[model samples]
Target: MEATSSNFTLSTILKTEDPYSSLMLAVAALVAIFCYFWIQGKAKSKNGPPLPPGPWPLPIVGNLPFLNSDILHTQFQALTQKHGPLMKIHLGSKLAIVVSSPEMAREVLKTHDITFANHDLPEVGKINTYGGEDILWSPYGTHWRRLRKLCVMKMFTTPTLEASYSTRREETRQTVVYMSEMARDGSPVNLGEQIFLSIFNVVTRMMWGATVEGEERTSLGNELKTLISDISDIEGIQNYSDFFPMVKDDDEKAPLSLTHVKSLLMDMVLGDSIVEESHLPKLPYLQAVMKETLRLHPTLPLLVPHRNSETSVVAGYTVPKDSKIFINVWAIHRDPKHWDEPNEFKPERFLENSLDFNGGDFKYLPFGSGRRICAAINMAERLVLFNIASLLHSFDWKAPKGQKFEVEEKFGLVLKLKSPLVAIPVPRLSDPKLYTA
Candidate 1:
């Protein structure tokens, strides 16, 4: 086991009478990678609560070689089921803890809320989010608090949201009119596309006011969405540097390139009563529908990931400082212990309960919890509720002929429909003016 420099020489290790120089260099790299992990394992803390149990790691690569990043949320759910709620998995040199149960989630997000306040900043996230200085990824400190306050007080305050009421109503009106046109033409519309555009317009109008309008504004929104989708696609790819930042990544064409991997580890309903923002309070069933949809499909399934600022113990397991933490809200939302008939889509069940996006309930945190809860909850609720109600009240949806309706999802960065929804909207409103702005 002792060192033998002669054994690693180009001629000796390559075992070729005339070994190519690049081949010799590649062989040398393999030996170095082996040594790096060996030293890292030995250098880790020996005294601490033992790390949570997980699948056995393989040499230098760790548990990463076993993960399928495309289905990482579901994959983590499966792993946590077998390894317990708090499971530790090594992604290269990076130690990550995945929490899938409500008890463990509370311990991480509530009990040790401050310690786990920061997100595990991925490389793609850094570039897209101004080197991770944005509110979502900024470190837990006064600066982040200021940003949050600015968002809550100045930006998303009730009065401010109320001020933008007309803008929201106008956008929803446009969507209603467009859908009405589709109904008149007997055409099937892509619900996802139309809704995204409406939401996009609402957001832009709120930000830029009515200064930008018509095709230019729509073009801007389309461009922005395309840009975001590109970023999401890039984030979905598992980059080796993210896992092993210690090792500099060579170009993809290199003999030992570790980059640009295709696979990597990383909802709505409607109803009708009044169908306006002011009417949302009285329409408990509509609210329940939104809650149930969120439960089944939490936007950021892992809640942007939490990184422990210091060594901590949660549920009798050690979570080392700076380790990546993932609370699988998707799994917790569907846990049978907390939710009866969790997998089934039952909006009525929510009608009996008081769970909501306020982030109080650990088992159903669609918008996360504690200080890190989403900044624009007020705006989001208004936009979502109003739009859903408007869509349902104004249109009687019909599936494309001979096609079975199904809701399948593909998870990464954010949850996405596996296939786009195609439905025809038959007008169901009493008066045509209700559909106008």
Candidate 2:
């Protein structure tokens, strides 16, 4: 270019400016040349594995300005509708990929399971969990594995669940009795609060029941529940710092029918007694209902959000290192390809099928899949199934007058019904003494 352009002669530059101008010109020329080559290099990258296609991001904010945190999972599913199974999304300066298909889910969760195994800890997570060192947000390595191992040994095995059966049974029976009393008065019960309290007691007892006793346990339990509730709300909030971490600037369940309500209610509780843990396996229908419920409404729809520790290829696309990974269990669960009449509450799909809570079949992950799957799945299954069976067995539910039953969901740190359920329990058991027994 210097040889071809007569107007850009060295003599002209020397004649026009001060001596310092020549040096300035030289520096500018070098920068221009460097930029030309850099552009060429970036252009060449397009020929290689491309990033999963997604909505076009704005200059610096990326897609941060577009997201609505209140309805996050639904928003993600909508984005996937246009971007295909594997969708790339940019939040602030960070990159995130949403996996919406079971095939894509398998690629990230199974084929490259270890690659995207690290939890993408939020700002609150680090603060609450002491710099995210706890098992929930810890990286996939020896330390985290050790913590998980300890938890498994302490509270998350079949043997441990069996040992704690009495506590679960006791708590569950008390709930039935409470409902029965409510039934006698024809008082409406908030089943949500009831189930949560019962589960909370079961969890608290299993976690530290042996350590704390009497009033101290009660006090601690109450405090723990409040703190947990607060923590969940805090964790759900969208923080500006989290979106633009490099930029310092500021600103910015249940229940039964005559014998099978929703397929979830079963015959296990038909006798004059509360459902027992021993009866769980004997009742395949109860298990199917559990599976169906989870499929329709996953506890954590996005599965706690994974992050790739290293650059990886997922579904033939370049998923860069440090990319936040979201396995959209909600969408995948309702995929028409895998499930027939996916929207319907059909438990029979799981009856003859071999799918279990182990996360083997990627198509139905109620408790998630891969190494980061819920550590206490055994305990959870045992607790939930037994409680649900017992509830359905003990009484029949009747929604208050003029209140329509709805399944609308409101996602948060956990998924919940948009409107809390208010239903009255009508005793279904043959013997009235069984309510207290």
Candidate 3:
């Protein structure tokens, strides 16, 4: 009887242990399920303010599938219709806030400027711009400030730009002579090619103190053209990694690798070349031309993407921290509200009105606004204006046979003529003595 009682006690202990084990397993299962749902809820929360609106996105991919690789601007504009000017979009998992209206832009660029001073450089942009070392691509920080000071005080100051005027005048004279010869020969000149060469020569000389000549010049010019063309090409748009940081995919890493390769190439070609210090006067006409070109064809129509430093409200919408922001300078420049016949190519508009391209004025922001504006503005403006004025003063331009001057634009980092600015050139109708004098 005692043996039987002991056996019953052992059986009872085994039964009790089974229930405890089962209970632990059930608890673990419940916790796992809760975690899965909790993670999903956190992701959904990142979609931004619900009332502001945006395109519907797919799981993981987001709205990336619907984006047009060629013309991002068109897609952005379409979103504005459904979501209003302050619309949110998901490129992969990343959240971007597109600002299309002037009022909204003014709020972000002017009223709350300091809060939006940081720029986000994409992988592709980082590669072509010397790992964001170039003035145009640098982010907002101490490095950016130091670089800006260098460009302004040393590279593009009025005195430095003016010193290069004689070189510009000489190049202009050559352009006129070449065109005059072409006109005399009755040969059709590719005006686009001519203009590009003239600008290339002027910029190269000023930057490096060297003139390209012979086969080397031709090859170098072609290489520069290819680099610029590649930068503008839309085929390289989708960078999955930029938007989805948590997903460790190989495709996302490809752009970063490509950027490294480009940096190496740029360093080999244009890195060591530096500008020397010299006393000179500033050329006002040249400065004007550069500003005008940038106005018409900004390197990045939207400029560098800026992220909000803190959660803030803009245009009646709550923008969370780390949200990608884009400013549509293209639409702003063409806005009928700010400009007269905004589509017209009128450089004289500046002379006729008090409008300026500096970030101080919200109406014309080719270099961008606030602390994140391009550091190379001063230098770029001087280079562009000097080249444009020299070409125009030296040569009279005409369209090719039966080809009218159509101002159709092609989008890129820099806006270029869709068909290339090819034209016939004639020498400026001026006396030789006057030109020499």
Give all candidates' CA lDDT scores. Answer: 0.76, 0.78, 0.62
Query: Would you give me the overall lDDT of model 2?
Result: 0.78
Question: Over the full model, what C-alpha lDDT does candidate 3 score relative to the true structure?
Answer: 0.62
TM-score of each: 0.83, 0.82, 0.70
TM for candidate 1 is 0.83
lDDT of 1 by residue, 1-437 (tens): 34686466656645655558667678888888778755654455456656788887776678988898778989999988899999989998789999999888889889999999998878777677788898988999999999998899998998999998988888888888778777888999877666777887788778885533454544555566568777876655556777888864411111110111101100022232235577677667667767877888888888787898998988877788899888899999989899998887777687787777887878989999987999988888898878876776677777789874566777887887677667899886566776654
Clashes of 3: 8
* lDDT accuracy of residue 305 in candidate 3: 68
Q: Give me the runs in candidate 1 sitting further than 4 Å from their true place.
A: 1-45, 211-224, 249-274
Give residue 302's error in model 2 in angstroms.
Answer: 0.9
TM-score ranking, high to low: 1, 2, 3
After superposing all C-alphas onto the true structure, candidate 1 shows an RMSD in angstroms of: 10.3
lDDT of 2 by residue, 410-430 (tens): 887777777776789999768
Ranking 1 against 3 by lDDT, winner: 1
